[model samples]
Target: MTSTLTRLPRPYQSYVYAYPHKTAYRPLAPRPTLHEVWAGEPRDPLSLYLHIPFCEIRCGFCNLFTRVGAPGDLTTRYLDALTRQAETVRACLGTEHSPRFANAAFGGGTPTFLEAGELIRLCDIAERVMGADLDAIGFSVETSPATATTDRLAVLAGRGATRISLGVQSFDENESRAAVRPQRRADVETALARIRDTAVDVLNIDLIYGIDGQTPASWRYSLDAALAWQPEEIYLYPLYVRPLTGLSRRDRAAADLAWDEQRLRLYREGRDHLLTQGYEQQSMRMFRRIDAPAPGPDDYSCQTDGMIGLGCGARSYTRNLHYSFDYAVSAQEVRAIIDSYTATTDFDRAVVGRAIDADEARRRHLLQSILQADGLPVADYRARFGTEPHTDFPVELARLAERGWLADTGPARLRLSPEGLAYSDAIGPEFFSTAVRAAMAEYELR
Candidate 1:
């Protein structure tokens, strides 16, 4: 277990988008069948995700499992494999489970990286093959400026995509070069215009801070540029230069106190600017326009429910186990993983995954809820877990209070203080179980 934090950890620790982090996952012994995995899981509704591991360009700071290009029959073969995986997954979920898909998302290197016709085929696999109703669900897609073509957006809009998230890391050309995300301001604007022509209910723009050569003035320039379009949502990500990424080969993003304080300053700047622009801060990375359209019925609550992911890089989560294919960051290793996935015929069992136990569940609930701006409802936590959060992890909670990271909102809630949310990256890892931390450390050494 990590020692009590009497002092502050680096502000830019690891991002906690998922619990147990995928790094903790290992090759399951005697792998559990999908049918068994879903046997007693909730059947009310689930989130659907289809991952495309192809991108036009690889960003320097990205460690996501994706390749730069899909040439010749690569896309076709990948889609065919996805179709097979979806059928197998649906058959395993079966009528006995009575699964209902409430919402869906197409994520990836770039889902829009496919051609216009390919996008249509991808939609067919989701609806016709997987039994999901895109037309009636809160469907979202991730895209990039180079691939957000008119025809592609038209197909997505026609297929009932409710939201589109475009990754425009930086509008400043120099900053982009520094991050190794090549693009021009003109291209980003053009893509935004094409998306506006569509009927998608929400549009999200992603920007990055802490890039080399990025100044407070330059960061504000990028923020003001994104604000001009009145996007429904904006995400300001702190740049991370992890091993196996392009930037890691360089000397940028030194993980010292200087880098941490610099990023903290930039985050405050971006957060304050968004609040003044009438945007509501949802989390450390997400800010939504105050008037942004509300989500539709059957929205997926990932914190509690299950998710079905049908891609090499995508991970599926049951209440206890989270599983997926092998993860790789380098181009060669990623290509090898994708090749294995495309050639695979048996998609019935979970080969690689981590099993979440009872104790971790409480920690996950608290960490996920506390990281958000709204905080966690203590009553709900007690009702569900049948115990108080403070009872489960007294040392962790007390340390937070001691650091002035935990807020006092009376006994009804367990929420992070404003200062706590600012250091969410540090706080999230404090909850990582000893088992998970060891596994992650072992993976890094390998």
Candidate 2:
């Protein structure tokens, strides 16, 4: 169905963080038990993800499943619900055939939004109930400048968080405000100092390009500011104003082509700047220092293994399906889902998600690999799927090659050129399955 003599489409359609977005999911008919859903899947150590939905403020360009604030003991109630869900999930996985976890992560509006004591309790649930050794597993946590408190970070370090990602969209105060993320440069520096005081081994700084008033010079200032910390990893994200986000209310990008061109220019600038500073491109968004800390015992790859997610906003992925509770961006729907999750006691069923069939699996493998800097290994793909990627998706490959997106580095691997990686946000959607496209199209926004 994907056939056309190719011409380049607009780059930056969307960020393909995961194949088949959450919007593609639906309520499961004859809801399957967690056991049935995971049965026959590889019991190899899986990645554990815990989602916390509260944040001090939502970024203007963010469409994540998180809410603005937690009122009157709501966080405590949420953690209680998390504990209950963990207990149930642990019981379902059972003693005889339970899946072992290799690593863990805490993500959301901001996980460090919890107080030091509350953070300890959250760690306890992960360690005691979920059977994940945080110290040994090298867990990661996400935080914002406003919430990266010394007490909370100390607790995280003491409990074994190896990595902490601080979302400081821009060090330029004006650019920060333009992005609807209110914070002073002084506050951001203070937060960075607090994070460095902790024992965390790897620090990832998140920055964005394409803010409303961002210029090349202003963009370089933020990049240089982030480098001042010499973080282990850095992510330069292009600003995408998704539906229902604060930026989406107004027409921020009246001229789509101009916006895309601006983003591309900034992206190339950021990529080149990092490279010169001894960082290696891990993907379109991620760059790692050449001397970054070596992998620990808990090194887990998201491409191959399954993920067991806790909290209302998280999703659990098995080889056969990806399941999660209802997803939302609007504050009202998000609060409603969290309320329902906290009140519910039955946690054994796979209520809503999409089933991944054979074809979808191949596409996922292809998408995940090709988007990275290393690109896809042809031998690996053939061995895994018993078919060459080119043979299976001739039209897709043709379209990509026609655009000069594919490099002539040889047939040993299916790799995207530098320009291809630049166009990743566009290239990713080119491989989405027709069924998934339909499902996403039909999903109604709240």
The C-alpha TM-scores of every prediction are: 0.97, 0.97
lDDT of 1 at 270: 94
lDDT of 1 by residue, 130-164 (tens): 88889988698999999999999999999999999
User: How far is 357's C-alpha from truth in model 2 (Å)?
Assistant: 0.4
Candidate 1 off by > 4 Å = 1-7, 252-254, 444-446
lDDT of 1 at 163: 95
- Residues 1-446, model 2: lDDT tens digits: 33121235778887899977999999999899987887777766788999999999988989998898899999999999999999988887878876778889999878998999999999999999999988887799999988999889999999999999999989999888888888999999999999998958999999999998899999999999999999999999999888889989976654477788888899999999999999999899999999999646644566668999999999998888999999988989999999999898889998899998889999999999989988998998898889999999999989989888887868899888889899999999999999999999999998
| TM-score: model 2 vs. ground truth | 0.97
Alpha-carbon lDDT, every model: 0.89, 0.89
